[model samples]
Target: MNLHQESSGEITLLKQKAFNLSSESIRDEIVSSAFRHTLAICQDVTKVKDQSKLLHTEKLDKILTSRLFGFPIMLAMLGIVIYLTIAGANVPSSMLASFFGWLEGYLSLGFQTINAPDWLHGVLVLGLYRGTSWVISVMLPPMAIFFPMFALLENYGYLPRVAFNMDRLFKKTGAHGKQSLTMAMGFGCNAAAIMSTRIIESPRERMLAILTNNFVPCNGRWPTLILLASIFMAAGFTGAAGTLVTAGVVVGMVVFGIIVTLAVSWVLSKTALKGVPTHYTLELPPYRKPQFMNTIIRATIDKSAFVLKRAIVIAAPAGVLTWILANIMVGDTSILMHIVQFLDPFAQQLGLDGFILMAFILGLPANEIVLPILLMGYLSTGAMIEVEDLDSLKKIFIDQGWTWITALNMMLFSLLHYPCGTTLINIYKETKSKKWTFLSFAIPTGLAIAVTFAIAQLARIFGWV
Candidate 1:
């Protein structure tokens, strides 16, 4: 201990402490003292006069991420998106169907005039015609309506708010905030979503994103979900309520999809790719006016065309295969029915029959083609059944023993099942490993089977059918 006294004391005695120290150490101590003293002075000078006038990210975060309004606002926005898509798609689809139907008729007449061979006529006129036309008619309208609005939202910088909204739940799953961004992209296309996983730097988190990306129903599956939900779920209601209810169910499936995504992410993170979420900042840009003309042009011409081209490439072969399956017969049963029968046992165990399952598998080449193939299978009834609208389509399903349970299963399966061909290829390319690609495919498919099985078995036990 050292005793010391200073400053106007009667007897000031200073105790001297002796230590062996290098000159460099003494200089370092002096420099540290000076630096801290300067910082203290600067801090005192810069202190704010009023705390309430402070502006920072925290204030902005409170308003955007408030518990009182965040989820409700999210649902409202989702409703608006679906409502716009449904309202905008109807007239365009009808117009395109009429134009394509005329073209098919013209091609048939031209073939007749040329005395075309039966096989030639069937292959080109019927197979290609029906395939390409169905793709164009069914796939085009939704893309046209959904993409521009999505792009506008993106361009306006609302995407980061989406990330902010989903971050806490995602963090619980040990996934990165950017995973939400990739999932949002999946709503446009799963392939694109998988590609966007590049933003996530961690291998474990990136893999989780890749594996669970398909949980958000992509644009490909939207038509099937929308059509079925509109037909079976909301059929009793009429007018505005019907539209709203249909949109509501569609949005509900979207919400359900997001839930499945988070659940799957949590499971995968804990079981296979275990880790904690690494920190990353999400910048929320100020909202800006969406360029009206450019938004539409880029959405339709660029985004829609890219997806459409992929669909066409996959759908053409699928269409021909579907046609063959419908036309060719073995003894008395057609090849399609034979295939469906082969799948029946497995499908029935899950509450879905062979035809429904087979159609989905075949349509994996493109989800847009699933309904078309199912239609072909139904129309091949060796009768001229002209399906005009949603009601007629529901009748076909009803004739095939589709209860409300079937409709429910169909919607769930469409939302949770395996992704399209492009997504499969994208997975393989992104992972650069066959193992991961297989896992990506198997995981969702396994969930789909499990969920469908539970729903079906429960319903059966309760005699809900």
Candidate 2:
């Protein structure tokens, strides 16, 4: 036979051989071989002075990943991170707000000097500028503090331990072990989290991760959660105690979100995307000293700035549109008021007012602007505004008839609502299926509405509102 014929024959024989092998057996063989090789290498070259001796890192891991202590440690660590972010960001956030507030006056003066119309001033200085300022002031400090710390953990190789600690839970949920990692990524940005689902090899599990990742509140929702927790949940306490209580409440919300993630994953796996969980070995990397400066620089530029830029881009245009709605009157009321009135009955049933619901609806583009929009709508202002402190913010909510039920429900709703517009776009792009993308939105939104409605009804029945 000629060369071409010989090559074709060999290819046919290889295909037949591959076809004859069972997939399960092939996978078992591959895993066995990999383990065998690893054992052989370690046995041949590894050395220890004492067989029972453990390194400092290994000792720490033992406690960190212990069955009884692991979760509590994780929660404690999370609380510390959140507390630090909340406490540290307060001063900078205030300074930024004051600076922006001062700049707003100059902006208005300049607009007047140029003979700009009132509407023009409202849209530019009050709407876009104020919106952007709120995002930066409220979001930047926490992100600057949070992302670098998170990156440090990642650099030190602690994050994989987090995944490892949750592996059993995920497995029981019929989801991939790595879904925990993606969910962790969701804390930074759900869009990025959805993209990270590609790490999950099983199609069904990947889809499950994509659908449920939004259960973990992203950075955009943090401000709202912190604001509500500090003002309402921690109100009775004072000083450092109050601050600690606020952080604890925020951490509790995060834990609640994780619980929801696991529950939803379990439900989807058992129903819509039924499948066996795929098993993969996760090799824990040796812990090392983190490159502190490098981690900070990379996280700030790559994660923090990237996410903030997207929020600003979306928020600016939304702000302009919000201004128009608030200013454009139909009959005696503005268009914004009309829509709020239309949604009022439904919102009240959910322990929220029309303005709150409207803010959430308008905030679909970027969650960072939700509070600002709510403030503008409630105050009947044509532009977004910021208060000087928590007391001022609390007074506004109280004056608007906000009870504990409303604050609690707002936190719950914010936690469970549909992913932001950017996240939805990412889901569609990743899944390449409108059905799954729609389900992603529908599942969370339906859950949000159902949960808040149930809580509200129960509160009313018990006279807790």
Candidate 3:
């Protein structure tokens, strides 16, 4: 009955009263488990909050993701990227073209010295060489510049903020917020983006992401857009201002593309694929110093090379086939000419011509191939022409009756259409359903047709033709 014994008895009685456990240890065990769970929950929230902080962001998020500034900042980022791709790409592309052209000359000289026939020289040195050269010269530089910047933003943890900002729109569209992240990946490569859709646990949302992913411009498409913008928009201005305006237009097109994507997603979710978009808890990782060497190596070796190889594989055959189409006569004209003539009506209706439309269809294997196909179609007329630089490309298009509207339509179609063959394959692999894959293909094509049709009609109504 001393004080110490009395205190011990009271503690035991309190524990027993709380849980009715015969053992005093049971109450302690329950309290410990609850505390651990509570601590874990708090840690998770803290981690999320800490990751959202931008060390050097300058409160930019307030403006960058604001309802007013969000769209404009997005456009600025896009324009800057495109401008960098265009202006920075020029020297490297010219160097690459010179090197490749030299190599071709050597290759042709060797073929002649070895007594190779004209047909062999034409097919190998001219056809395949010209096609693959365009891919390397045009694609390599922009990708080298663009991918690293993309990786830097991604590495700096800015992209997650982009996703966070976009989540609500995705939710409204009945798509997953994580779809924004996947769309970012699509800018690298649509196939990779489609694969990244796996991050979404919901099957329905994943399919939606896969189908809509191509709305974002992929690396392969950038060269085409940048080239188009520079030719039609930038060419008028001299020096730095021209560069800025070209970049701005290219960026504007991309922003327009994204707007179209969101609109299409909203429509699809409400109709063909109607459902609620599932929400995901995205934990933004901390911004770290981007490893420059690793990014260069990975972007060059992993991204650029991988994309290049696939494109070359597809382009070589496409080159040969294109050459054959251009060379082989169908009564009075080459098969390519006849085919272009046949499709001209529909192509014109879309504010493009048959050759451009044909290029797009053939280029479906790889967006890198479209310009090459168009070149082959043009060069096959025994012109002895060579596309030595971006300016030369502009000449070809102009000679072929290209107007501002043609360039605009080409850019729009490139932005709006279904992704390439590799992307389609990735979608099929990820979704594991042909029906959804078909839907993926159908939706984008349908939209591309509809949107271009409207633009074409508007242009004609305005007498811009």
Candidate 4:
């Protein structure tokens, strides 16, 4: 044969050879072989085994990553982190709220001095500004406190062990084990969590992670959940007992979210995203002392700012709209009531009032502004509501006909609702499919409505409400 013909034959043979090989098993065997060779070389040249740090890490790992003790320790650590975040943010949040309220008074006075139109003043100060201020005051403190400590755990390498611990559970749902990492990241921010799904090698598994990331309440929802739990659920209790009970409720919500995530993943895997789960090895690194200050600084700047900036940007417009809704007249009633009235019948079926439902709709941009919008909807005085204290806020909700069932449903809906605008955009960007983006939105929202509706009906039937 001529030279060109000979080259074509060689290329065709290589293609045939590659076609015969199982792609999954091929790289795995190669990696296994490489590790064996590297180990042999290390054994040939290296000495002084049983290094101190290595020994300590292994010993700790025995308990921390053990099948028996791992789950309990993980739960305990979660409770501790949650408790610290809740306790630490309370004072700073109140201080920020008071400071902002003081600043708002000056701005309002300036508007009055300028003789700005009443409409203009109300829109600027009450509608737009209060919305953003509540977001900052409420979201900033907990996020600032929660994320840095989360970063510390990350820097110290405990997060991967968390992934290791959750691996089997995820696999049973036909998801990649590394989805646990994305889920953990979701505790901070769902948009960031969706982005973190890049670590999952399989496209199917990554999609699973992206779709379910919102099940776990993000940082924005934490303040609302904690406040509701403390105010309504822990009504008859006080002191350490009340605090623990609230924390337990929060943790239970997380566990419930995980179960819902797994159930959804399993259903999706069986139907829409049909595939067998592919396994990958997870490398557990030796624990090292995290750089305390550096971790704090990065988490504060990177994480807090990431969520805060988006919340503020969305809060501005949402706040203005809420103000308009509350102020604009329809006959004798405000336009807010008109919309709320339309939604109330349907909302009641889900154990939520129209004001609560409207808040969630407006909060599509950012979950941080939900409570503020809801408060605005409930107000008849056209005065800005200050969520400065849990007691006052709880009183307002109670006045609005809120009960434990309402609180329970609120938490459930918040946990399972559609992604925020930013997160939806991120999901679209990651998936590059309008279809998947819509499904990601539709799936959670439908589930939320159905679940809440069922709970509401069951509660009524059993007279639990």
Candidate 5:
């Protein structure tokens, strides 16, 4: 205790160690050598270890980490997780939607009963209330299901295996291998993913991960892609087959996003952030039994609710603005239509209408609200609308002149678009620089526009639309 307290000797000792950085090369080498020697001694001295457990872990690792099977297994596991989320959320989402619809009716009746002003009713009930409820109804169930499963997988120590498998690919792109772990976290939430970049030791590689993380569609954007896949891509199928197809498309998008992340990382390494890639040894922890219920509770409180709360906060006010825009007129047409019309010309070249583009702009605060915004814009109902019925949504899109091309492009655009406001804020916090924050937003937005434009044009040229 006396030695721990401050004294003249403490000052002398601190001065002696002040310039010794623990993470420096000399320190790392010393620690690495110590660990290696210790490990060798332990392995030699240990006897009659749990051979069954060791053999089981080794066998599982052999298959999961195989050169040929690793990527395929990773994709299949992703498909399964997505399938579970989509299938499990379907019934609950509809029930929530119905409950919200029922409550809205009573709220509207209460307003009318009190002789409330029509505009006030519209703002509070139709706009604010509807928008928030839309988020809860649509966003909650899927997130509720997805995050727990994701957390469970993470707790099982599978993410390091992912990093191990993708390390070679990332190294080729001049990025830190552990970026794969951060990128996997992105599947849950990009803001969280940005924060996770602290695990990477190299500032340049960390920035590469931060900038490219948005390409991987997060929890908020998955709803949009899943909805589109259900409505259009899987329309020809039914039951389990339909579900599988939707999951398959989502898996394909995820793979594409990863490819884009690598490509962008390579580009940045060669040009802006040019530097030799740093290397690190990744320790793959042994798998452990994840307590399912505890994981679910933690995931729900820590991830799902946090994201949903942020979405509701933004969606409510944005809903009012959308309602106002849709209601207030410029001459004969509503201001919303006027704006959509203005954007339509440019947006069409991207294979998306003005309303869709405008929705993307308005929904920048939260990706979960993008579909609801687009729905309300399409109907021009002066309020947000929540629809979980794929058939009805398909009909609405068809009425709006949507084709397979529109659906395909919408999925791509959603997958590739700008990071949400929350993610940008987190990026700024992580980077502590306005310059890199702007690049984080700009890089993905530009790529989304460029890629969608190229694909849309190619489809047109081939008469595929």
Candidate 6:
């Protein structure tokens, strides 16, 4: 044979070899052998003199990973983190809101002094500045508190334990084990979580992770959840008890989101993304003492600031557009009023009003601005309103015919609806498939509508609404 024929034969042989080795059983046997060989050469060189410390660590791990106790412990830890965020964020959020409210007065005065037009002042100060301020005040505190706590867990190596605890559930759902990590990341920022799916080696599993990342509530949604829980759900209680109850409600929402994530992952796996789950080894790392300052700094700068910056960037332009829509009068009513009236019937079926639905639609650019937009619409102010406190906010909702059902459905919709513009863009970029990107939006939105409609109808039938 000539040289060309010889090269062709070699390439064909390699392809045949690859094909033969691609079976799951064959791959498992190869992995087992490799691990066995590595263990044969490796030795525990360090002698642990203190058996007490080792015993304590092992005992803790046993409890943490126990099937009966593991999930509860994980949830308890989550509740604690959220409780801390809710308690810690209130003071700073109020201060920031006050400062911004004071600054707005100056801005309005500056505009008038400079002879700026009413439209220009309204769009810039009443719309863009107000929106950005609301986002910062509401979003920054919870993130500042939540991210550092999350980072401390990460630094202490507890996060891997969480992933280990969640691995089996993911595997059963036909997703990669590392998807739990991405889901946790999603709690901080869905865009970042979507990006983190690169860690999954399998293309199919990675895509699954990206599609489901939005099921977890991100920092942008925290403000809405916190506000609603505080105003509507925890209204009966007062003081620290009320705050704790509010935190519990938020934690319940997080758990519900996780349940939705798993359910959707299962449905996707059985249908559009059918495949057997591939196994991968996850080595639990030894827990270490977390460096407090480093954890805070990194979490604040890398996670908190990164997410907040993206929200502000998207929210500013949305604020301008929202202002224009609210202010531009077509007939007897503003364009915003007309759109809200159009959506009222369908929104009513979902236990929400027209203004609430319109707020959510307009707030698609950034979830952080949803409540402010809703307030603007309800108040007929044609600009975002900054309430002094939760009481005032609650009163506004009451005036607008909001009840427990409205709050409940609103929270559920916020939890399950289509992702923000940033998350959608990231989904498209990561999947590079319009079909998957559309599914990413469609799946959650359909679920939101179905769930809210069912609950609203049932409540009405039972006279509970």
lDDT leader? 2
Candidate 2 structure quality by residue, lDDT tens digits, 1-465: 654565566556545666677664455455655675566668768886664434766887898888989889889888988998988999999999999899999999999899999988998888888888888888888888888999999988889889989988998898988999999989878988999999999999999899999999898899999889989999889878988999999999999999999999999999999988887678878677899998899887886667568857888888888999999999999999999999999999999999999999999988999999999988887889887777888999999999989999999999999999999999999999999989999999999999999999999999997
lDDT of 4: 0.86
Model 2 local distance difference test score: 0.88
TM-score of each: 0.85, 0.90, 0.84, 0.90, 0.90, 0.91
lDDT of each: 0.79, 0.88, 0.77, 0.86, 0.86, 0.87
CA RMSD of each candidate after superposition? 9.7, 6.8, 8.8, 6.4, 7.4, 6.8
- The better candidate by TM-score, 2 or 5, is 2
Better of 3 and 5 by lDDT: 5
Q: What is residue 334's positional error in candidate 5, in angstroms?
A: 1.8
The 10-residue segment with the lowest total lDDT in model 3? 379-388
Candidate 1: residue pairs that collide: none
Model 1: runs farther than 4 Å from truth? 1-61, 381-386
Better of 5 and 6 by lDDT: 6
Against the true structure, candidate 4 reaches a TM-score of 0.90
Pairs in clash, predicted candidate 3: none
- Model 5 residue 371 CA deviation (Å) reads 1.3
Q: Which is the winner by lDDT between candidate 1 and candidate 6?
A: 6
Give stretches of model 6 more than 4 Å off: 1-41, 44-54
Q: What is the lDDT of residue 160 in candidate 6?
A: 88
Model 4 weakest 10-residue run by lDDT: 24-33
Q: In candidate 2, list every pair of residues with a backbone clash.
A: none
Question: How many residue pairs of model 2 clash at the backbone?
Answer: 0
In candidate 3 the C-alpha lDDT for residue 435 amounts to 93
lDDT, candidate 1, at 456: 94
lDDT, candidate 5, 251-280, per-residue tens: 989999999999999999999999887765
Prediction 3 global C-alpha lDDT: 0.77
Q: Clash pairs of candidate 6?
A: none
